[model samples]
Target chain A: MVKDDMANLMKKIPIESVTLGIGDVARATGVAQSKLRYWESKGYIKNHAVTDKSNRKFTYKTVLQVQLIKSFLADGYTLTSAVARAQKRAIYLDALRSFFEDRFAQMDVADHTATIDLGPFDPTPSKHLMAKRTDQQWRFYLATPES
Target chain B: MVKDDMANLMKKIPIESVTLGIGDVARATGVAQSKLRYWESKGYIKNHAVTDKSNRKFTYKTVLQVQLIKSFLADGYTLTSAVARAQKRAIYLDALRSFFEDRFAQMDVADHTATIDLGPFDPTPSKHLMAKRTDQQWRFYLATPES
Candidate 1:
């Protein structure tokens, strides 16, 4: 029964179902092949099937990560900074999806469709506050709670 | 009293705080001056004082917006898309800041630091979802609620 349950869980999770080529990833993510290669060289991204320097295969998830990194770069972050943000975002997204999956699985058994309070999406204000506010803004808040 | 409050509110906000030249904006944001000029020309960003083609003054907010746009562009979005995202982010950030101010104002009167449930940090998943999921992922969720 445990074996069956494990198999079922594996099936539910998107566990390495499809593989994509570098070209496919570039096309899917709207990122140029040259940039993709550059990112790989810079260690910002990795190719799973690094059979050769010229030929490589990547998972769909890698494509997603590349897209995330690209979007960050587009927003004006340095390549290094973008990569860091992408990595952190990936972890956060994975946690959110896992939470959703676990909750959805339980909800299926009960057949209930009520709003689930996924408490405190992000607790840290600094993490979400992409822009660093000036000291004045902070002082204003501190000085005048009524304002 | 009302006029004084309005004046105080404007003063507290980062409205017309500091003006920066194109060079300063570029240096501060790590964006090219040429790109900043281009963005301004294209109406994506604004300069507070446009004296001539060569000389312009932008607010600190403009510098931040330019940085945001540049990051978006690096992420592989079209220039137009990046601009749109930057605009949306500006609006969202303002709303978030206002919410924080209101909450902080109330908390000051209460003298409490309890966990204020600012529910649904991300109401729109599409805006926040860095990677666009294929239909397969959605179908999986729909088909296998039990999983």
Candidate 2:
């Protein structure tokens, strides 16, 4: 039971400490290695150096940053604006992460329908905050265990 | 039915064009308007000018950006590094948004179990990718409509 709980918790939160080389990040994101270095030099992205200062290593987070900048650049934004826009989008992601970590208790599916159990309601702990979807429609309700 | 589809889609995607005044943003994010203006001047963030250049209105996206920067600053990151870190996080959010938009088919709950129906598998379109949770354990499987 303890192992299962740990696994469930680990699955919800991203591992931020995983580091990759600049080459690996460039390959994953499709951004050139030179461009990645330039962004780091410009203070738009960062690299984690282990022991040696010349060796560039980036966390999984930095790879995502590169992808975002590339996406904004593809959408015709200036480099400066792209970085700014990416920063803005990051905040929304933070909220989503928090929601998943805090409220996402469980998920179940039956007959093509999916139910996301958002744990218990704050005002009414006896009822769960359930988000249900059937076909393309989504509905939310507070319901007891029996219901 | 068409109106319902539109509403559903709109609910899934965030409205990016909603603009707020600097004061409103400051009040919402608890970051001073002066700091926001300074960040703008430094090209760390942006504002939309409706008719005049001096009248600054920011999109809902920018408001989120301010909050992210403030959070990172609280975490003891330098302003430049904080913005960079925020940009990295934004990429993860973009991927999450895409997943919710493209694959999230439905959700259902019964007997305290929640299921998330992730539409259909690309390799096997007839089977849906269902993620279910009962108690603290999560399980994933592919199932047909009848099953």
Candidate 3:
């Protein structure tokens, strides 16, 4: 019955189970207490209620939102910029995912583990050119298909 | 054959493949061009040695390294801290991987996933709480776990 009844509400965070203090939040999110206070002061989050002698109980949604925000901040977003473009959350996330994929690919210990686009060559520049053109002292940036 | 022949050398950076003008590095990393030039002047990175007549080229490696530094900066780090803690090539790549992992995780629609963990509950009030308790809001900081 618990499973059947709860299944209906599973799509949303349950309000009753949403009672966690700072310690619980810290354990769940791996964030520090001092930093959470700073986030509250900066208005990155708002609590739904403060009861049972003024202890802050965070909702599940707040936890996920905080996680997303933390990820963006980690990916080189300014707090102000992150706030302003909060709705376009996907962009920063994409950058983060691509980074992970590249790392995982590198972990593959196989001959074809490298994932690079050497470009669509005309088939004339043989492996010899690949060697000679690779000037050890020079630096070059290859363009991504989109960039 | 080319890939096989250079398997040993693959671990070494293809420094020649990095490409960035100071301006590009600035824009991509959100650092000022003057700062980029200053960092280079300070020997964080060096330009290629050239014949008397030379065209400037920057490798993608430098750009990616700069991106890694920028990620650390966004995570509330200073240039000094980043250089000290994240200078190892593996560290840079790990930062990139973690960033991307988060982004990828967000992409999954997560179709109403729910999990529950339940255990024993002691309803008895603790004797340790015999003293008076304060009512002001207890503030704390928390960040989601690293991806």
Per residue, candidate 3 scores C-alpha lDDT tens digits across A16-118 of: 2334455545545666878777777787766544454675655434554455556557789987665544434323322222322322222211121212222
Ranking according to TM-score, highest score first: 2, 1, 3
* 1 or 2, greater by lDDT: 2
Q: Which has the greatest TM-score? A: 2
Model 3: TM-score, first chain: 0.46
- Candidate 2 yields a Cα-based lDDT of 0.59
Across residues B1-147, which tens digit of lDDT does each residue of candidate 2 receive? 001121133242243433445765675577898999999889887767556655676644565567677878999999999898655444333333434665555555444455656666444668765656556454555678655
Task: Order the candidates by lDDT, highest first.
Answer: 2, 1, 3
**lDDT per residue, candidate 3, B1-147, as tens digits?**
001111112112222322334544454455677766666676665564234375333333455455555666778988877654434542323332322222122221112221111111112112110101113211111122222
Residue runs of model 2 more than 4 Å from their true location after superposition: A1-8, A11-13, A108-115, A122-125, A132-141, B1-147
Q: How far is candidate 3 from the true structure (C-alpha RMSD, Å)?
A: 25.3
Task: Please tell me which predicted candidate would have the highest lDDT against the true structure.
Answer: 2
lDDT per residue as tens, model 1, A1-147: 001121122232242333445655665567899998888888778766534654565554566577678877889999999898667544432432443343222101011111111122122322221211243232111011111
Each candidate structure's TM-score, on Cα atoms with residue i matched to residue i, is 0.33, 0.43, 0.28
Q: Which docking class does model 1 fall in?
A: incorrect
Docking class of 3: incorrect
